[model samples]
Target: MKIKALLAASVAGVMFAGSVLAGTLDDVRARGKLNCIINTGLAGFAAPDDKGNWQGFDVDFCKAVAAAVLGDANKVSYTTATGKTRFTKLAAGEGEILSRNTTWTFSRDVDLAQTFIGVNYYDGQGFMVPKKLGVKSAKELDGASVCIQTGTTTELNLAEFFAGNNMKYNPVPIETNAEAQELYKAGRCDVYTTDASGLYATKMSFDNPEAHVVLPEIVSKEPLGPVVRHGDDQWADIVSWVLRAMMSAEEKGITSKNVKKLAAQDNKDKEINRLLGKDPLQGLSKLGLSADWAVNVISQVGNYAESFERNLYPLTIVRGMNALYKDGGLHYIPPIK
Candidate 1:
């Protein structure tokens, strides 16, 4: 009797999981809006603008997904999540896509039952200190009070880095980037540690950015990307390909200004034509996207390079590892065809 009951439960669970997977695209269409989860506030990544509108690199990625899925870039609702609450909110279904500047890790992908589609930014953990502190290298910061976001890979990385280096430090935990900024600015913490890009962003936000210097050492690899719940391959494809479309658009010299014209004409490059929906690419329909989905993404939200320059340039973030593969960086366009 017990064995029979267990078998029945297993079958029921599979059915439930199947439904959840199949229903994501339908749910987004029926609701007419994409729910995007993002960081609480990280300058140049996922922070609000002067007019109370969310605008940043991650924000542009979310908008691109909305454009691809809903045909309207503005048809997105944003939910801000701190380091501690991000996974819980995503698992609880508070959002359709987690477009936060979240690090892709093993435990997050497997143990948490979340799927990281692909990396949008390749980064490494780094440290920052005020010039007054006179810290040149990460190795110089012994016994420093570090302001770090709680419940993040940064925390574990911090501990491991310090332990490995035979250094001791005090931790100042905060929930959001905004809180960390305030604490660090108020001199509550002697150092700030996070993604190198984040360190640059944080440093740029200060009254005197030159007063703080990001350390020369980069500690851990942080491949940041968008995420979706597991068991949804179709939904995952839609999200993943949206990023791919943007990247390929840049590689093919297709910008927002010219995408519409290119889509209307016959292009010599078959991939460009296929990507712009001038020719059919099999399985776009299977992914529950329109033929012109890539068009919408590039036209409405701009390509990946445009988004990066518009958002991150202000922070002085150089396109080091985030640059295209052809440009001696890590980003590679998965062939659109």
Candidate 2:
């Protein structure tokens, strides 16, 4: 009976692989566009621009993947979701990639059967309050009402932070950042809490951003990145490598401005040559990508730094921990070889 059970499990595994894992690439190629799930609205991350085009750091990552896969950065159809619905939408095949500011948690990574490709942004949870409250620190808010998005780590962190500090507070549960922003503006909550990046993004959307102050107490670490469903390792590798390629291009000083020139040259840097497809890079054929996939990604989406600076720099979000490792940031790109 044990042997029979083992055989049944093996057969199930094969069937699962055949059904779910296979054909992601083929489906994407046939569709002629990459379906990316993104936040409903977050400035500097995934919000639509004034011109109605999606453009931001996270949006650029989606574009990077589309460039690598579909050969056109603009070949992406975005589906927006709230924090509670992003996973469900991704699991239901509404999108191929979730490139929002999603945190990598054990439950979501392991239990939800999703793969966090890599950390694109290192962030921490913070509190934002109107300066009219005159609270200098988070500790001063003993009985403050905090507006937090439901179905996020921010909810638990807010509870713990208040308890740990021997304080009490009222919870203002919200479904989306937009809702939270509205509640915050209406003074329904004394403070708004979320990832510091999100706080800044939300603040930027306000009529008077300077009226709010982000408290210094960072409550939790948020390792935000792109996510793909499990079972499609090939698809996962392709998306993961798109991020690596952008970072590698930045590290090698290959900007969009220079990638075209560098790809056409025969420089002595073997990695540079290999990266831009000047020379044959092994394993491209297996991934069903052209030799110039990295070239397309960099030229179209720009390097990671370019994307960050272009989208996030306006928020005054200096690349404090988001910088490359050599430059004292947490970003460390793997080898292109």
Candidate 3:
């Protein structure tokens, strides 16, 4: 009958989808490396070192996932992506995880068929101007030409903020953060607008960091985090828990310096024991990852705070909203037990 044919087609469609989604983990295992997408050059978030090795806060997350899944932190291949091409690259399977500082939004989550694991940084848009500009507040720049990155939430946020304030300004749009910095330094624009954390990072990269000041106004909420493609629940769970493991390690006082020792001994605390793989945590097997996954992440990548301090401290970015829940910040992860 017609109804039977329709049901068979629906079942076949689901099976095809499942087969495609299920291959990410197996493919990663077979290849022995994780292909992680990152920003072209965003200091303190994702940038290459002098040796051409990628290292930063966001880069640490990619390394952590590599450690968790592959048992080796260095077994990751980095692909630099601009804002415009990041999603397409991710959806096309060009990269397994996008660890760039991308904002989590409704359209990106549902419409684009991607899943944001969780917020790594709670950020807000702000304006930065040269100290010589003599502009103390964002509102003071009514006719200022603003340098912003194209294909980002920043462009839309800049327009809305200006219009809401009954202000008019010229937009100096660029594609990458490096480009924005170049134009801003060249005086092509009077102000540079981005996340406040990024403003500090940009300032640090300048010839004289002290010559610029980030204004106090926070224009929009940007809960930036790692992302993965949709239809792969197991892959999504693996990535999500890898991040949570870092946070939980920080909360439990396990650091890269002591993670190996902690993993070797039996701890009295149930959660610590389970997290360190002294006791088997159920459901890890379903994800096709080892029981020592959390141990690998902590020992190799350190915890969330460690990664943040190592990368962001040079930029003088404080742990305002990135601190743990007990420390009165927004980074609260679910219970590991």
lDDT of 3: 0.91
State every prediction's TM-score relative to the real structure. 0.93, 0.93, 0.93
Against the true structure, candidate 2 has what lDDT? 0.92
> How do the residues 1-337 of candidate 3 rate in per-residue lDDT, one tens digit apiece?
9999999999976654542445789889999999999999889998889998998999999999999999999999999899999997787677899999899999989999999999998999999999998999899999999999887899899999999999999999998899899999999999999888889999999989999999999999999999998988899999999999999999999999998898999887889988998898888799898888988999889999899999999999999988998999998889887
Put down candidate 2 lDDT per residue, 1-337, tens digits, no spaces. Answer: 9999999999977654543446799999998998999988899998888899988899999999999998999999999999998897788787899998999999999999999999999999999999998999999999889899887788888888899999999998999999889999999999999999999999988999999999999989899999999999899999999999999988999999999999999988999999999888888888999989999999998999999999999887889999999999999999988
Model 1 is weakest, by summed lDDT over 10 consecutive residues, at 13-22
Q: Give candidate 1's error at residue 255 in angstroms.
A: 0.4
Residue 321 error for model 3, in Å? 0.7
Cα RMSD to native, each candidate? Answer: 5.5, 6.3, 6.6
Query: How many clashes does each candidate structure show, in the order listed?
Result: 0, 0, 0
RMSD score of candidate 3 (Å): 6.6
Please identify model 3 stretches exceeding 4 Å from their true place.
Answer: 1-20
The digit string of per-residue lDDT tens for model 1 on 251-270 reads 99999999999999999999
